[model samples]
Structures are given as C-alpha cells and as structure tokens.
Target: MARIGVIGTGYVGLVTAVGMATLGHEVVGMDKDEGKIRKLKGGEPPFYEEGLEDYLKRAMEEGRLRFTLSTEEAVKGARYVFIAVNTPMDDDGSADLSQLLSASRSIARALDGFSILIVRSTAPVGSLDAMVEVMREEGKERGRDYELAYNPEFLREGTGIYDFLNPSRIVVGADTPEVAEEVMSLYEGINSPKLTTSIKNAQIIKYASNAFLAARVSFINEIAAVCEALGGDVWDVAEGIGLDPRIGRHYLRPGPGYSGPCLPKDLMALIRMSEEYGHFPHFLEAIHLRNEAQKRRVVWKVKEALGGVFTGKTVGVLGLTFKPNTDDVRNSISIPILRRMSKQGARVKAYDPMGGENAKAIFGDAVEVYNDPYEALDGVDAVLILTAWEEFAKLDWDRIRERVRRPYIVDSVGIFRRGAPEGWRAWTVGKGDLPSPEVSPESDV
Candidate 1:
C-alpha cells in the first residue's frame, strides 16, 4: 500500500483521508486548525456526513488514518500528496486560490522525496497551470523532483462517501502519461470507470458538471412557473421527460433553486472564465440569476399564502441546510429567505436536524432556531418546508396541524399531500390541481 497525505480537513479532504485509509493505505490528513485536528484525532469530525463518523473511527482504530497540524509531518515519506483544500469564490465572482497556493507551497517545501501532488479541489479551468508555476517558483523541479496531477473530486455533500467509493467515473489529469497512470494506481481499490485527460479538461469537467446540474434545477423551476401559469403539473412533466433514456431522471426535481458550496460558486467561476475568453455565456448567467430568484420566489409564496401582509406574521421554516444529511449552510436558501421575511416585518422561526447551530449563528435575532421541528411550528401562522429531509417527510401531519395557528403550509419540496389532514391547506410545487374539500364544522381551518 502506498502512503497517502491529504491537506485540508473539510468535507472532501477529511473524507479522502479516512476513505483512503479504509482502502488499506496509511493516510495522513493535515489542517491548519488545531481544534479540527484535535477533534479528528479524538475520533470526532467537525462536520456531519452520513457514515463518516463510523468510517473515521474504524480507520483510526485500524491505525490506517491519522491527522496532523504540521505540513511537514503530512508530506514527509508520502508517495502521494493530495491537495483537497478550498478554493473559495471572491466577491467579484472569481475564485480566490490563496489557500490552495499556500498549501501547494507548503507541500513543495515539505517534499522529502519524489511524490505525486494530486489536486482534488474544485478549481478554475487553467488553475493547474498556475499551481504548477507556483510550485516551480518554490524551487521544486517538475517531473524530476516531484510530479503534478489534477484529479478533481466529484462527491455530493450528503452521500459524499458513497459517491467517493463508488464514483460514476474517475478522472485523472496529469502533465505526463506516466504520472497519470501512477495517480490512477492510487484509485485501484475503487472500482469505477477511469479516464485520463489533460489537466485543463479535467478542471473544466468539474465546473461543467456542476453548471449543467444547476441549469437543470433552474430550467425546472422556470418550467414549474409555466406549469402553474398553464394549470399543469411539473412532476408529470419531469416524469415524462425523464422516462427518455437521453434525459435521465436526476436534477429535474425542483425546489428553492440550487445552493451549496459547489454549484453556485462553480457556475459563477465558469461564467467568469467564459467572460475572460471573450465569450459571454448568457445561459450560465441566467441559471445563476434564476437560482437567486427561486429563493425570492419562496418568500413570495410565503407572503402570498399569508394574504400579502408580512407584518406581525410568524412563519415557521423547516430545514435550514441547503440539502439533507449535512450541516453545511454555506449557501442555504433558508437564510436569505428568513432575512428577507424579517426585513419585511415578519417573524421567523427555523429548525434543521443538523444545521440548528449554524442557523442560530447566522440568523442571530433575525430568526429563532429550534431544535425540535414541532417547536418551530408552535403558534406560527404558516410553515415553509425548505429542505426535503427524511424527518420532514415523516412528520406527524395531525400533530403539526394542532401546533400551527393555521393549517397552511408552503411545501417547496413536494412532501405534503393535497388534502391529508381533512382541513389543512398545503401548496405543493408541481401539484396538478388544488383540491377543495367540503369543510365540516370541525374542519374550519
């Protein structure tokens, strides 16, 4: 088994570290944050991902996985050094690779022997060229002293571990065929279709993949609007198109737009790159704008459901994280929707299974975060279901109706039925028609 060293301890890095160890490789992961390192060393991960804790604990127990705060310790005597750090987007929509450059320079200085530095971060199209230049400036001779390769990670937030081990495809971009084959050997344990290409193609593939997924979401949202306009259903439309082999049934389900660490940032970065190349991508730009508009669309649905008066209205928000099974709230739609509602003189109460603390930190007094989902609904006029979490799916509709002031629900996710509680009124996305049942004396909601 080859020794592996991974930098950064975020979702991708931490997963890579523990995952590689589970594949029988001795792996060392490094992070600058001492607190994170301590937590990782104590068999605890800073964030939540499904099955990561168990996988981490097992790797630690097996003596295959370890974390370090020192870069020197991580890179020394390692055959493969993977850079899985963040390349956060700047204010002007460009990617700030300061952290990536810093990590590369650290790796260069700490390189004790011939090792392959595989970049697994989601960077710009030509970022590998810049990283190579940066490493060369650090007095490291490329292809002789060390080798560079680009192997961008394509793991989802919730099911990242599964995606990693059972990837649909594995991409390896390198300066030479020999280096690419060596990188591919590292993933010999993983049984996925592999592809070797240029560094630039590998880099662009990540961005293009996310951009297309985000566009699918935005297109469906726009189609959802039209479905409502023409008195049709988006679910039916999605199913009809999804049945075709060419257009698979994924990313067609619509909600409050796409928002996470990857989609929005990658979409913007690709747009910026296209602009730099003198080709203004109107389609990508529109996809981005439509995503933000989807958030506002949720607010509008809430306001309209509450009879157009935001003042003195207390709305309960369900699920603050962008998606389920993760506590990451980097670009969650619930935050902005809650802030906009509060600005319009409405009170907000939110509850997320894992994102409660993150919501409390971000919203402060603007939104009151609740640990229990029912507590958030206590005495609220309306409840807006943002994320399609499993708990939200299995909620007691009978008990929920008793807690809320009104049985009115704006289900952004199509979890609620049309007439489940007899009198509860729910507005679900892509529902073909709204039902008007006969209200009894006990059913006047």
Candidate 2:
C-alpha cells in the first residue's frame, strides 16, 4: 500500500482520503480549516454526505486514515499528494485558483523527496502547468524533485463514496508515461478502466463532461416547456428517445434547471475558458442561457398557478436542494423561486429531507424551513415539489389535502404520476394533464 496525502477536506478531498485509506493505503487528509479538521478527526463529516462518517470511522480504526491541519504533517513521507482544494468561480466565471495555488506552494515547500502531485481540482486547462511553474519557482524541478499530474474527480455529492469505489472510468494526465503509470497504480483497487492523456486534456475532460451534461439537461427542459404548451408528454418522449443507445437516458429529466456544486459553475467556467482561448462557444452559451431562463420559467409557473398574483399569497415548497439526498443548494432553483415569491409578498415555507440547514443558511428569514413535509404545507396557497425525494413522494396526499389552504399543486418532479385527487387542481412538468380549477361545476356564477 502506498502512502497518500490529500490537501483540502471538502467533499472531494475528504471522500478521496477516506476511500484511498479504505483501499489499504495510509492516508493523511489536510485542511486549512482548523475546525473542519477537528470535526473529521472526531469522526464527524463537516457536511451532509451519506456513507462518509462510517467510512471515515472505519478507516480511522484501521489506522489507515487520519486528518490534520498542517500541510507538512500530511506531505511528509507521502508518495502521492492529491490537491483537492476548491477552485471557486470568480465574478467573470473564471476559476479562482487562489486556494489551489496556495496549497500547491505550501506542498512545494514541504516536498522532501520525489512525490507525484495529483491535481484533483476542477480547474481550467494549463492549471497543471501553472502548478508545475509554482513548484519550479519554489526551487523544485519537475523531473528531479517532483512531478505534476491532473486527475479530475467525477464524484457526485450524495453517492460519492460509492462512485469512488466503483467509478465508470479513471483518467490521469501526467507529464510522462512513468508518472501516469504510477498514478494508475494508486487506483488499482478500483475496477475501472484507466485513461492516460496529456495534462491539458485531463483538465478539459472534467469541464467538458460537466458542460455536456448541463447541455442535455437544458435541452430536455426546453422540450418539457414545449410539451407543457402543446399537450405532449416529455417523460414518454424522453423514454422513446433514450431507447437509442447513443442517446442514453441520463440527465434528461426535466426540472427547473441544473444546479449543484458543479453543473452551473462548470458551464459558466467552460464558456469563460473557451473565450480565453479565442473560441466562441455558441452552443454552450445557449445551454447556459437556457438554464437561467428555466429558473425564471419556474417562478412564472408558480405565479400563474396563483392566479397571476403573489400579493398576500402563501407558497409551500417540498424541496430546497438541487436534488435529493444531498445538502448542497448552490444555484438551486428553489432558492430563486422561493426568494422571488417572498419578495412579491408571498410567504414561503419549505421542507427538504437533507437540505434544510443549508436552506436556512441561504434563505434566512425570507423562507421558512420545516422538519415535517406536512408542516411545510400547512395553510399554504400552493405546493410545489421541486426535488424528487422518496419521502416527499410518499407524503399522505389525504393529509396534505386537509392541511393545504388551497388545492393548487404543481409537481415539477413527476411525483403525482397517477394524477391528483378528483376535486383538486394540479399541474406537473411535461405531463400536460392540468385539471380545471377546483370550482364546483354545478355552480353557475
């Protein structure tokens, strides 16, 4: 087993450390955040990721994994140093590499012997070269003192641990074939095909993959809107189109928009990166613009369901996260929708299985976060299902009907596939089966 040092204890860094340790490697995870290091060392995950604590605890007990705040302690005597630091998006959608560059400089100073530095951060092309430059400026020649490699991560937040152990593919782009081989050996435990490429290709691979997925999502969302207008069903249309192996059935689900730690920012960053390289990515720009438009469309849907007014109205939201089983709410559609409603004098209440804390942090007093789904719906004028959580799907419709102040329901996630109750008004994405408003047909106004 090789000795591994991972810098950064975020979702990517911490998960990679625990996973590598579980594979029988001695791992030390480092983070500048003292409190985050303390929490991980105490067997607590700083964020809400499933299966993280158990893996961390098990690896800790096995003496294979440890957490630290000192980069020196982590890098000393390590064969592989994985740079998993955050590359946040700047105002112009360029990746802010301040943290990554700082980590690289710190790691450069601590390099004792020949150790492979793997950049697992989602950065622009040539970032690996930039790190190599940093190492050279720190008095370490690439071939003599150290080496740099780009190995981007594809781990999703909720199912990250599993994805790490069972990745679809592993890619590492190094300066030399020898370094690529060494990087491959580190992932020998994972039964995934390894692809070796140039460092620039690997960096672009991550960005390109994310941008393509975001494009598919936006494309389907546009079709979903058309379906809603023309009495067509998007789910069935997607099903038929997905049967073709070339057009696989992934990221095709219609929703308000694609959000999370990756999709939105990655698309924007890719666009910016392309511009920097003197390329005008018109198609990618369309995808980006369509995503923003989708969120606004959702807000319009909510207002339309409320009889074209939000003044003095109340809305209940069933989910706050971008998706189910994750606490990440970065760029989530629910945020804009809920905030827009609140600004229009419509009180907003929301419940999520895992994202409530993050929702509270983001929305503050503007939106109400609730523990129980029924409680979130209590006396609201309309209910919107933004995320596809099983708990939200299995809600007692009978009880919800009694608790909700109005019968107006909009399911953007296809929760009510069997259709809503007879006497209620309902709408959904792409289904196009909107029942008439809940006015008694026998009454002649």
Candidate 3:
C-alpha cells in the first residue's frame, strides 16, 4: 500500500482520506483548521456523510489513518499526496484556482523527495497544465522534484462512501504514462475499469459530465412547463425517453432545478474554460439560462396556485436544503423562493430533514425554522414541497390537509398524491396524474 497524504478536510477530502485508509493504506490528512483536526483525531467525522464515521473510526483503530494540522508533517514520506482542495466559483462564475494553487504550493514546498502529487479537486480544463510550472518553481526553490497528475473525483454527497468504494471507472491524467500508471495503482484492489488519458481530457470530463446533467434537468424543467400547459406529465415523457438504451436511466428525476455546490458552478466554469480557448459553449450557456428561468417558474407557480393573493398569506416551505440527505444549501432554490415570497408580504415557515442548520444560516429571521414538517404546515395558507425528501412523500397528508388554512399543495417534486384530500387543491410539475382543479357548485354555495 502506498503512503497517502490528503489536503483539505471538507466533505471530499475527509471521505477520500478515510476511504483510502480503509483500503489499508497509511493515510495522513492535513488541514490548517486545528479544531477540525482535533475532532478528526478523536475519531469523529468533521461533517455528515452516511456511514463515514464508522469507517473513519475503524481506519483510525487499525492505525492506517492519521490527522494533522501541519501540511509538512502530512506530506513527509508520503508517496501520493492528494490535493483535494476546493476550486470555488468567482463572481464572474469562473473557477477560482486560488485555493488550489495555494495548496499545491504548500505541498510542493514541503516535498521531501520524489513524491507523486495528485490533483483530486474538481477543476477547469487545462487547470493542471500550470501545476508543473508552479510546482517546479517551488521545488527548485526547495531543492527537490515532484511528479504531478490530475485525478478528478465523481463521488456524490450522502452516497459518497459507497461511490468511492465501488466507483464505475477510475480516470487518471498525467504528463507521462508512467505517472498515470502510478496513480492508477493506488486503486489496485478495486476491480473497476480504469482510463488513463491526457490531463486535459480528465479535467474536461468532470465539467462535461456535470454540465450534461444540468442540461438534462433544465431541459426537463422547460418540458415540464409545456407539460403543465398541455395537460401532460413530464415524468412520463422523460421516462419514455429514458428507457432507450442510448439514453439510459440516471439523473432524470425532476425537482427544484439543479443546485447543491456542483452543477451550477461547473457549468459556468466550463463556459469560461471553453471561451478561454476561443470556443463558445452555446448548449452550456442555454442550460445555465434555462435553470435560472426555471427558478422563476417555481415562484410563478406559487403565485398562480395562490389565485393571485400574496399579502397576509401563510406559506409553508417544505425542504429548505438544495436536496435531501444533505445539509449543504449552496445555491439552493428554496432560498430564492423564500426571499421572493417574503418580499410579497407572505410569512414563510420552512423545515428540512437535515438542512436546518445551514438553512437557518441563510434564511435568518426571514423564515421560521420548524423541527417538524407538520409544524411548518400548521395554519399555513399553502404548502410547497421544494425538495423530495422520502418523508415528505409519506407525509400525513390528511393531517397536513387539516392543518393548513387553505388545503392548497404545490409540489415541485411531484411527491404528493393528486386527489388524496377532499376540497384540497394540489399541483405537481411534469406529471399527467394531476387533473385540472375540479370545482363544485356546493363549494361556492
């Protein structure tokens, strides 16, 4: 087993560090945050990832995993140093490599000998092209040399551990086939397919993959609008197309547009990266524009469902986070919806299964945080399901119907039943299941 050093202690870094350790490699994780290192040293995971804590504790107990606040200590004697830092998006939506470059410089300065530096962070195309120059500069200053490779991660949150353990394919991009093979050997035990390509291809693949998924989401949302107009269901339409082997079935589920850290930022990065080479990404540009419009569409639906009354109404927001089983609220659609509704003089109450803390930070006093989903629904005029948490699907709809002042349900995720409650109004996106609102003469009488 190769000795591994991991930089950054965020979701990706922690998971990669512990996961490699679990594979029986001697791994050291380095982060400048002393508090986080202390927590990790105590066998506690720094963030919430299902089943990650158990593996972390097991790896530590097996003496295969270690944590330190010093990058020098972590990189010393490490054969493979994984740079898993963040490449956050800047104001203009370009991938900001400030954090990544800083980490690479530190790793390079602390290099003891001929160690392979792996760029595991999600970066723009040709991002690692400059890594050799930067690291060479640092290495010359420190009288040493280091090999570099680009290895982007595709692990999704919540299911990150499983994805890492059982990845579909491993891609390694390097300056030489020898370095690429060296990076590939780190996954020796895993029996998955491996692809070794130029560093540029590996870098572009991550952005291309995320942009395609974002496009699919935006495409479906746009179709859902037409579906709503023509009395059609988007789910059925998408499913029909997804059944084709060429299309396959994945990321076709519709919801409050794509968000949560990756897709939105990656699309922008891809656009900028492509433009740098004098190539315009028209399709990606359309995807980004479509997603923004889709967010506005959600607000329009709420207003339409409310029958044009916005003032003095109680709106219950279910699912505050970007998605379920995650607390990350980066660019969550719920924030914008709540902001819009609040501007319309509507009092909004919100709840999420796991995103409350993050939502609280974003929403502040703009929204009332509820521990129970029913509490958010209590006495509200209308209920909107923004995220498709499994619990939201099985909500005591009868109880919710009784609690809400007006039994109106606007389901963006199509999690609620269409006609479950009498005298209740409900609408869902992209579903042919919901018939038009039926009005009875007795209702007016």
Candidate 4:
C-alpha cells in the first residue's frame, strides 16, 4: 500500500485522505485548523457528507487513516502527497491561489523523499508550473526532490465519498508517462476509465467540465424562462432535447441556476484565464450573467405572488444550501435570494434539514432560521423552495395550508412541478399554470 499525505483537510482533502485509507493505504490528513483536526481525530467530520463519518471511523479503527496539524508529519515518508487546498475566487473573479501555493511551499520544505505532488484543487491551467516555481524557491530540485501532477477532483459536496470511490473517469496529468502511471496505480482497485495527459490539459479539463455544467444549467434555466413565456413546460422541453445522444439527460433540471462552490467559481476563473490568454469568452460570460438573473427572477416571482411588494410579507424558505444532502451555504443561490427578500422588507423564515446552522450564521438577523419546517411556514404569505431536499417534497402540505396566511408557493426548484397540495396556488419554473382554480379552493395563477 502506498503511503499518502493529504494537505488542507477541507472538503476535497479530507475525502481523499479517507478514500485512500479505505483502499488500504496509510494516509495522513493535515490542516491548520485546530478545531477541525481535533474533530477529525475524534471521528467527527467538520461538514456533512453522506457516509463520511462511518468511513472515517472505520479507517481510523483499521489504523490506516489519521489527522495532524503538522505538514511535516503529513508528508514525511509519504510517496504520494495530494494538494487539495481551497482556491477561493478573488474579487476580480480570478482564483486566489494563496492557500494552494502555501501548501506547496510547505510540502517542498517538508519533503523527506521523492514524492509525487498531485494537485486535486480546482485551479487555472498553468498552476502546476507555478507550484514548480514555488518549490524551486525553496531550494528543491524538481526531478531529484519531487514531481508534480494534476489530478483534479470532481466530487460533489453531499456525495463526495461515493463519487470518489465510484468516479466515472480518472485523469492524471504529468510530464512523463511513468509519472502518470505511478499516480494511476493508486486507484488501481477502482474500475474506471483513466486518462493521462499534460498538466495543462488536466487543469483545463476540470475548469472546462465545471464551466460546461454551469452552461447546461444556465441554458436550461433560460429555456425554462422561454417555456414559461410560450406556455410550455421546461421539464418536457429538457427531456425532448436531452434525449439526443449527444446531449445526455443530465444537468438539465431548471432551478435558481447553478450556485455551488465549484460551478460558479470555476466558471469565473475560466473566464478570467481565457481573458488573460487574449480570448474573450462571450458564451461563458453570458452563462454567468444568466445565472445571476435567474436568482433575481425567483425573488421577482415571490414579489409578484405577494401582490408585487415584499413589504409586510413573510416568506418561509424551505432550503438554504446550494443543493440537498450537504450543509454547505457558501455561494448558494439562496443566500442572495434571501438577502434580497430581507432587504426588500420581507420577513424571511428559513429552514434546512442539514444547512440550518451554516445558513443561520450567514443570514444572521436578516433571516429568522427555524428548526421545524412547519413552524417556518406558520403565518407565511408564500413558501419559497430553493434547495431540492426530498423531505421538502414529502412535507405535510395539508398542515402547511392551514398555518400559512396564503397557500402560495414559489417553487424555484420545481419540487412541486408534478403537483402541490390541493387548494395551493404555486408558481413553478417552466410550468405556465399550476393547481388550477377548479382543483383548488382559491384561483390565483
């Protein structure tokens, strides 16, 4: 079994550490956050991911995984060191590589033997070259001391563990075939397609993948708008278009646009990188602008449902995270939507099955976060569904109908496209009219 070191211990790094350990490798995860390290040492995951705690505890019990704050301890005697640090977007839309570069420098300083430093962080195309330069500044020779490779992660937040173990494809980018093969060996137990190429291509692969997915989301959302205008259903439209073999049925669901950490950040970073390379990415820029407009459209829907004004209205939000099954609120479309509603004199009551605390911290006094979904809906003018949590679909809508001032729903995520509770007036994306007056007690479409 190969000895592996994972730096950063954030979403990406922690998953990699545990995944590799589960594959029978001795792994160490390093992070500067004392509280996070302490939690991991006690079999606690700092964030929510399905099956992460079970796997973490199992790996620790098997003596294959451990956590530490010392970079030296993480990389010492390790043959493969994965750099999975955060590359947050800057105010100018470029990826701030401060944390990534710092991790590289630390690895360079702590190198005890020849190790392959595989970058799993989402970065711009020439980031590996910058890492080489950083290590060179630390008096480390590239060939003799270490090698660099790019192995970008494509794990989603909620299903990171499952995605890691059952990846569709694995791409390793290195200077030589031997280096690529060495890195690919780490995942030999997993049966999947593996590709090896230049580091630049691997980096572009990651950014391009995210940008394309975001484009698909924005594309469908725009189509949803068009469908609404033409009195057509986006669900049928997306299905008809997605049936084409070239366009598989994925990422076509329309909502408040794509808002997770990776899609928005990577799309912006790719746009910045393209501009730096003397290319204007018009399509990419439009996709981003469209996503922003989609969020505003959701708020506008809420206002329209409440008689064109947010003043003296209560909006009970169903979900806050970007998506379901994760407790992450960073870059969630709900944040901007909630902030806009609260700013416009609307009382916002929000709840999430998992993201409540994180969303509460972010919204503060602006939003009244509730633990109970039914309580949040009490005396509300309209219910806004942002994240598509399954529980929201299974909510006791009959109970909700009796509590709310008005049984109005702005279903941004289309959770009620199939049908909402009887006697409820709802505005669903892509669907022109829903819950007809004949089927409901009140008639407001």
Model 4, residue 205: C-alpha shift (Å): 0.4
Assess every candidate by TM-score: 0.95, 0.95, 0.94, 0.96
- The per-model lDDT (C-alpha) reads 0.86, 0.86, 0.83, 0.91
* lDDT, model 3: 0.83
In candidate 1, position 179 carries an lDDT of: 86
Compose the digit string of candidate 2's lDDT tens values, residues 1-445. 9999999989999989999998999999999999899898899989888888899899999899998989999999998999999988899988888898899999999989888889998989866677878888999898888888889899888988989999989999987888998998898868888999888888889999999999999999999989878888898888887888999999988887888778888888899989999999999999989988988877777787777778888899999989998988877878878888899989898899888988898999999999888898999888888998888667777788887777777787777756765555677777765654434322221
TM-score-superior candidate, 2 or 4: 4
| Cα lDDT of model 1 by residue, 1-445, tens digit | 9899999989999988987888889999999999899999999999988888899999999999999999999999999999999998889897889999999889989998999888999888767777778889998888777888899898988777888889999999986888899889888878889999888888888889999999999999888877876778888898898899899999999788888788988999999988987999998999999888888888988887777777888999999999988999887888788899999999898899999998788888999999998888998888899998978867887888887777888888777633444557877776657752223312445
User: lDDT tens digits, residues 109-152, model 3?
Assistant: 88887788888899877666566667767753312467778888
Highest lDDT model number: 4
Displacement of residue 439 (Cα, Å) in model 2 is 12
Best by TM-score: 4
Clashing pairs for model 1 are: none
Please list the residue runs of candidate 4 whose C-alpha ends up more than 4 Å from where it truly belongs after superposition: 435-445
Error of 2 at 93 (Å): 1.2
Q: lDDT of candidate 1 vs native?
A: 0.86
